[model samples]
Target: MSAADAELRQAFAQLQAQMVETQQRVSALEPQMAGLQRAQLHADATLQQLALAGAGGGGGGGGAENRAYQPVGRAFLLQPLPELKAAAADRRSNADAKLEALKTMKDYLERTLKNSENNLREMVQQRKEQASS
Candidate 1:
């Protein structure tokens, strides 16, 4: 093959590798995004339940005594209910931010893949024309 053809082939291989890596990254992000969404839903439900319980006056203000147990590895730690709620809110916010970042990355990768495919096609066409000539 000519030097130009070899260079084009090398570039195509690199782009193919990058496309596979991007696909893997997107797959990894999918699960993380789903987990975050599930956590956010759980947090929202917990907050709603707390609100309802408080509005119903169920236990006079003993809700303050409510302790939330947080899991740490194989153990659990006792935290106040309000503090747990705050932590859950923070987790939800962080998950949302990460999800947004992943989405941006996915978009960029898709665009790059499209551009690379177009370039590869153009290079192949040029090579064919050169061979014919």
Candidate 2:
């Protein structure tokens, strides 16, 4: 085969390798994404339950002894709520970022594959013309 043919083959091989690798990564991420979605659903359910309990007087039912409870212990306990919110926000952001990145990578791989296939077809056409000549 000519140099052009050989180079075309090499390019296609590299593109195929990249497509395989990226697809594998995308596949691996899918399960994690599903799990995240499930976790988010669970968190929403828990938040709803907490809200209902708070409304129904099921929570904070400590009776007369709880009346003297001052601000000190409450402040310490309430401190973690902000941290928890921040953590959930961060996880959601990370999951969104990762999903976008995977989509971009998938798009790139598809484009590269298409280009490689077209180039290979053109190379074959050129080889045919050269042989005919």
Q: Using Cα atoms with residue i matched to residue i, what is each candidate's TM-score against the true structure?
A: 0.75, 0.53
Q: 1-133, model 2: which lDDT tens digit per residue? A: 6887788678767756765775676577678667767766655654454444444543465322221211354462333333444455565666577667756776776676667567667767876798798
Residues 24-71, candidate 1: write the lDDT tens digits. Answer: 777777888788788778878877765555455445566776766777
TM-score of the candidate numbered 1? 0.75
Alpha carbon deviation, residue 78, candidate 1 (Å): 6.0
What is the number of residue pairs that collide in model 1? 0
lDDT of 1: 0.76
Cα lDDT of all candidates, in order?
0.76, 0.58
